[model samples]
Target chain A: MDLINSVTFKDLKAPLFIAWQINSECNLGCLHCCEEAGHPMPDQMHKDQIFNFLRQIIELKIPYVALSGGEPLLHPQFFEICEFLRQFNISLKVETNGEFIDRNLAKIFARLKFRSVQISLDGATKDTHERLRLRGDWNKTVSACKALIEEKVNTEIVFVPTKFNIHEIGELIDLAYSLGVWGVYTGKIMRIGRAAKNWDILCPSDEEYDVFFAVLNKKIAQYDGRMKVYYYPYDVIEELKYRLRYPSASLLVIPNGKVKLIGPLPFICGDLRKHSLIQVWENYKQAWSNPKVVEFAKKVIEEPWLVSEANDWIELYH
Target chain B: MVFTAHTKIREEKFGAVIFETLKEKIFITNRTGKDILNLLQKGSTLEEIVDTLVNSYSAPITNIRNDVTNFINQLKDNSILTR
Candidate 1:
């Protein structure tokens, strides 16, 4: 049948999507931030360099781009970058903390017609959310969602299921639905960034995660496509399945513009500044065949804890 | 007639995935359907496709012809296969 769909993993000649981390800068000090991003990093790319990168991405004709960071909106020229990328007809998804999204920002996003803006909303209540996100203001986030929804900007919620907010999974979904979000995405807290330091406090126990997933599954069934609910690490299984059907399907770009096979893995394919998009992609594909990378991928699959211990491995290897 | 210039096809285990980049549409088809598409990709005519399928498959010629016709019509309707 004629299915109106975006580019699938199988259709891509190179990488299907690029997760572009504009900068390692975030306003809030979230305990579970995988990048450990809070203050603006000194090495953040200049506006001109970002524009050049966007031009190269367009030239390479990458179909999908996910703008992320400490907070992508924190980039001085965030809207300018988005506008530049829009010129090349790239489908865009922005991941943000939602604090920066006001009525004006919502209008800008609606005008741009972005694919979706995924905002983090860890809990249903202020206390629960702030417990993990630290200085996160619940009302501001709620208002941002409402404004985005009202402006008809495609909005999604990201809820990282941690010990503090695991019990609030159902309530969070209800809250997202009430805010008229298109989806609610959640995943296990990876042991990276500040989360690695606070693993004992932040990481949920196996049983806790199991219970949380069960609740999520039930809610997904209840919603039944009224709203989308996605859980990561678990969803990585779907990626593995897709890989079985079509080989060579994913890539990750860190804040420093280095291409990696996985976010946590220290294996660097190539730096975007030095290499062309195709060169970086070829390097990534080549790394997939490297014995070290292959073995690492295998080990990560076999021992899930390896992902949590990625920072240590990176230090040892890099 | 041939598949549109914007359309690209990739073989999958169970079927083939057809992507229309212009419209951003994806079409997944069965092996038999994929077989037809493979032939069409190299600029095969309806008669040629039917003849090839007759040789390759055990189905009755009339049934194969009817199915191929319907499939081609569907592709055309979807602007996947174009003149």
Candidate 2:
């Protein structure tokens, strides 16, 4: 696709990736899952809808597409969808919890040939992990991680920082490296979805989350590029240090798509169903001067009431 | 197209980005004497970009269009646009 000559939102060259959440239904009901599994699935975008949607993505020539779900592996047409999307020359990333993996699935994963696979892990030990995941299978996750490693597939383990598991951050990092995995990425539990429902248990206060990142940073520094780590908000001292020392490994992507500038804010960039992608980007450009949206984003960072709530417990660790 | 070598156009800020795609240039300014320049991309139009922001942010249609018109003129006077 030829590059569009017009620059609307801050001279954007183009979008490089799009994170598509096809379905929100998942088998495991993890205590920390943001997608909260029991809701009815939204109507699946029909083939034509998907085709039309994909045409916009193709026009941008985004090199990567990360397909996520309550558990994306559960989609009945999982493989077929992969084959179809493969036609567009996009590298794929399948995000899953790993309970669904097996030899047959591994073979398919290897064959379908995604760019990478990421399995979510809350803790390094079975007891700690099972505690947060409720009925989750830690052994299965470990087995799946090993299988992907053996296959020489690019695999990552995503750890969501919560009150219960934040104390053992070092062990999780060591566990990932010991298994010969590519790297580990930890995200702060934003107050949304099922995570919001269990806020008392999941959100460990901003202070605690900061301490958790600090401890993980100490351990992470020892490896020094053998493995990589990324965190959200990009405000942590550790992350700033890491970026200064080795800038190439970290990156951030807008989950819905980077089509508009008004993204990365509290308000959504309207429904893509009713408008063309170009139209979406254009409107986002005009929204930059929106006083309300700008004010909201500022308050989240400046006030961050959530930070105060987590500060007391966080001091102990830091 | 109008031209002024050192015209300064007011730039607007977006979510976490800014509307600075139009580099400094010379162009025609509307009656309000605002230069509207460098807004068009290969498949984009001034109206289309304004419409997208309006839809995404749920802004009032009338106000956004009005601001866009002023912005367009500002750019035009700066000679930042080809058309």
Candidate 3:
């Protein structure tokens, strides 16, 4: 696509990307899953509702979408959704656990020409990886990653650093390089979902963060531009301020059709199920300044622990 | 039909991307949007844009007009275009 910048929220008619939580279902029980996926929701988005949202996205000229879930690939109509998106110029990115992405699925993903397929692999060593990813098969994840790379699909490993996995950051990067994947996307694990339950153990200590920065730089140098390493330096206070100051252009669509802010604010801007996308978007533009949203942002800033209570979206505005 | 100085347009393989320098925001358009932007960059009139689209694409003239109008209005609303 072409390059355009120097813009304000007014210039943005629609979200450039939609982080659609396709379903509240997953097979793996990751220790820090933000969606806390496993059991499927009975009232999950109906097929018609999903296609309706897809039509809305097309009408708005959305260019990008990320398909995520408890496990997005688990959606029965996932391939159909990909085919539909292929009809338009929209680019897709998939977030998967890599357990179910066998050779056939990997081939299908490659054929679809996704922008990137990010698979979660918290640890480099099998012992460490399984420890973080409860019920996760290390061999399956590695094999799935290898299959994607073999099929020439752009693959990136999503890693979460904690005290257990902090020391393995370099090794994980090395492993990613050896696999010949595209990139390594990692950051401080958000204290939400199951993570909040076990934060006392999963949260990395200050000493471990010192090792994280050093090894992260060392691996970047060692890779020598062969692989991309994306590390988001997450600071809650700064992020809260920035998010409040700058208007958000993207809307986070949860599996239940609730439109909320991208980061874990927990304030529901509008419900896509209740109104058309345009109406919801119109409301969402002003939602940041809505007293409820503003107060929550300020509260999160002052009492960062409030984020721990943000496991579910709170319906305040529509 | 020229884009304002606030906007910088770059042509890409799929479509053109418009950059608003003031806000440092980007607008990614599709191939059709690229075609329209190409005409605007050349200072083509709105009627000429419609005429060109009518000749080039198989869509009905009404749909084409609406799309062009909406695209233009969006840009104008953002001050990327003045008139």
Candidate 4:
């Protein structure tokens, strides 16, 4: 039913969802590493800090949370954090490399009723996948996916289209189908961190992208909802500007509790350690109009130096 | 009778999130709408869905039917579901 009077993102008190980088460490520093995550950061949040912010999550009644990492499973208290969030009425999801998901972990995911588990696979074939990720990781990840799918864990494959792997999307779709995955999410690799450093070599040409999407669309129609296809073909600048107007709707929470508007642009709007989630959201809303942010966005569009500030958290003066 | 090829329905604690991948649009559903979508996913026909809602919910049969029909129509209008 349509509403009588509508409230949009501007009117929201808290974020609709959160993309929380629970830890700065990751298993593989792949070509598309937005965080450029490798080892845990020096300022990584302590368990107390994370739990404190989670308390704020409950207080604000945030409905959805998508946990990520370097690899989220690498976080020491990962299961404890998941259990804490599950106690509340939060709809939880995870983005992982799928290296750590085993039969027992998959069973735990099923028991916890995770909304979705996104496992990244750059390509269908081992050579391409290994080239993008770690060698032998493709096999480990695919095995993890099989475990999760076997336990009916609502698993989805996350593919980042690039110059290296766009050609094999047809085979990738078939692989997802064979694995009985719930969905296939193919999103554009944004220009940030490692992606920015490797933009010349990594970004797919427009024609390459067109061909890739054509194959993807054909498979979508052929499968006919048997395997869901989710594609996000957004330009980094456009997506950043869109997030500016609607910052409160969804947020990116970095490992140390700093809130970033978008990954491609370096703008830290708030600190969860210092403020409540709502307060951080209010800070985020103002960050969009921050002259520094506008200048940075423009500068990145012109010069290619945003790479230096890629993973830097440029805290706003709010 | 079924969701569109790229359409996905993910249920949440508060309600459900419907993804229309063709346009990259997202729609949120309340408990009633979520239940209707769940039934549709389970291959329940329109009449079966209405009957089930009428029997379970305290609303009148006509009202339930009206709500279900409108919800289904919205899904169809958005190209999220098809026969």
Candidate 5:
């Protein structure tokens, strides 16, 4: 099948990918967490509602679904939801911190055949990793990697480059490669959520970012096909362009069941509870014409800093 | 030369999407490239491909032959085609 064909402007009724924030609950309060998710929010959608939404997702024929959040694994019915998604042959990807993954959980993931499981590993050692992750234990993450690799899970590591861990980028990539991971995704920390409050400390300087990418590009070229390494915002521009061409290419379903284009952007397309997924999709399509969304797109391209400042859009639009 | 067994080609509105599953590489082509790929999939010979394109398009036979040959050689280099 044509992979690019899957991404087109012709389809407004279906989205190419859905970023489903299962719940705003996480065990670790990482310094760079965009959602600032730690405790389980009371307003999260219930199990039945999520299942109903999944049914709508299948009916709409969405090709890919990324289960994200503070951490999706913390959801009470996480496995049940994965099993349900599997029944419909939907491609699944999960974003997690890797702390919850043990031998048993790794086995479950392998058996389910997830397209990819991206685990956050910000630093090479406990001192560096825990510095940003706060409650994270580097040893546990290493053990989780071993377990997942043992089960032959298609595992990938996510490295959020910050001032605290910027020096360890090379070491971290080597570590991920040694752990038998299929890919390593590293990106500059966006100034949002908890990171926003600590931007001065957490954000790397422009020169630091340029140096980091230079080294990362060399490493990626050297490794070639052995393991893939991607730098975010840099890599995401293509996806953003695709979204600009077809505004409905992505749909972010928040913890409370409200859909938005990019999570930080304040535009509410529709609430899953009140509207069917199809109706929500139509609302998303309608959003492209909204003067605010159009303006936001223009500003995003011209003023890159606006991406880091979520609330700034609120001020500009509201 | 024949298209590799692992290569999968799909026709798209703009052109064609060719995937080499073994290499996990995807290539997109223009309308003429798509037509060339379609002919290759049907096991057409190099000369036949040139002849077909010459008939379908307004291009001269000599130019069509050169382009088809270059295209096939490029695909072969990329491992999308094999003997």
Candidate 6:
């Protein structure tokens, strides 16, 4: 079944996962850490703060939330927070590096009932993987993937294609299948965070990604339902026009109760806490219809400075 | 301070633009005036507004100044301007 149907860009459902980094501390410093890894642990969110935010999210009736961190698992009360959030009838999507998803952790993951778990693996082989992740244990990450699948959790392998691992993307897809992940998401390398700092080494040129996603679609076609695929920025490629048409079928509730109008715009158009979901939607309608805002968006898409700001938080976690 | 909202209008010549914070919605008639209206807003001085239009739009400030002064007068004559 093709996940993407004959929908135009206007029809796609809004995004469901409002991805936010609750903390910036990570145990492993990957070479391409978008948020620029290896920073000291940030002031962890107090339990009350997170719970309060989740309550606001529940009040807003948003359907999903994703908590990321340098390593969200590293948070002292990570599991407790997850358990606390389960009462709200909201699906949780966890984007983790998988260094912490061992047997004991797998039990916790199962209990949380995460709708989906996305683990990052840059290369299909250990040699290439270790090189990109820097002190990353490929075997351990693979083991974690196997554990999640065995537990029957919907799992996705996220491959951030950089110059280092661009060539081995085909092999990585095979690796994802071997582990029985529900899908694999090979994302483009954005030149915003550390990728910007190490542009020469990390950012893949247009020619490189052309071959990467080409092979990816070919693999998707070959495997059929054994796996599914999704991309970031859901690029405006002609072949992918069908995917854009689906009204972004997702809604993101940030820690501060901000309902991002679209996937992580540089500016917050309205706060869900201060306004109802319908109110927020109205503001977006107003903002969209406003010529000034529309012009600004056109400029943002055409210019790098504004786009870089919206993606700045990605660099902080990298 | 409950501010009055004008009818939202657009002009293609000056590109996509929204002129708010003026008297009850005035439909900007000329493309040149639309270019000036893009920068005119609350708390903006005639001088500051003229400066932005002159530097950014690159249409002589004197020409824009006269247009803006006339637009403000028209709105005032229509009882749209408070101050």
Which of the predicted structures, 1 or 2, would earn the higher DockQ when compared with the native?
A: 1
TM-score, model 5 to reference = 0.76
lDDT of 2 at B62: 87
Highest TM-score, which number? 3
Q: Could you tell me the lDDT of residue B70 within candidate 2? A: 62
10 residues in a row with least lDDT, candidate 1 chain B: B17-26
lDDT of 2 by residue, B1-83 (tens): 33232222332221111111112121222322221233343345667756665765566978767777666564444354334
| Least well predicted 10-residue stretch by lDDT in candidate 5 chain A | A309-318
- How would you encode candidate 2's per-residue C-alpha lDDT over A1-318 as one tens digit per residue? 011223332343333345676666677788877556544355555556666767876675444667777677777666766776666646677898888887677777777666678899889899888888877899999999988877777788999888888887888889998998777888676554566568787778878877887887787787667876655555333332333333221112222222222212334443455566555544544444456545544554555543222211111000
The candidates' DockQ values read 0.11, 0.02, 0.11, 0.10, 0.08, 0.01
Segments in model 3 whose C-alpha atoms lie over 4 Å from true places = A1-5, B1-83
Which rank order by DockQ, best down to worst? 3, 1, 4, 5, 2, 6
lDDT tens readout by residue for model 5, A1-318 = 122334343433466578998888888888888777888878789878888899988776665678998788888889999998877766688998889999999999989877778888989988999999988989988888889899988888999888999988988988888889988987666656777787788888889888888889888997788998877663333444556665645688888787776654556788887789877777777777778877776776666555566533232211
Tens digit of lDDT per residue, candidate 1, span A169-267? 999998888888988888766766688788889878889988898999999998876988776663333343334334445567766666666665667
Q: Output the lDDT of residue B78, model 1.
A: 77
Best by DockQ: 3
Per residue, candidate 3 scores C-alpha lDDT tens digits across A14-131 of 6666788889888788887766778887778888988999999888767677889889888999988888886674677788989998999889988887777899998999999999
Q: Provide the clashing-pair count of each candidate structure.
A: 0, 34, 14, 1, 0, 36
lDDT for position A59 in model 6: 58
- Give the per-residue lDDT of model 6 (tens digit) for A1-318: 011123321321222234656666677878777666555433444666666656655554444567776677777767776786666545677888898898777877877777678899888899998998887889989999998888887788899888899999889988888889888886666544565567678878899988987897888787786677656554322212322233343344444445443442444556544555555544544444455545545665566445445543221010
List runs of model 1 lying over 4 Å from the truth: A1-12, A233-248, A299-305, A308-318, B1-83
Instruction: Give residue B53's lDDT in candidate 6 (0 to 100).
Output: 69
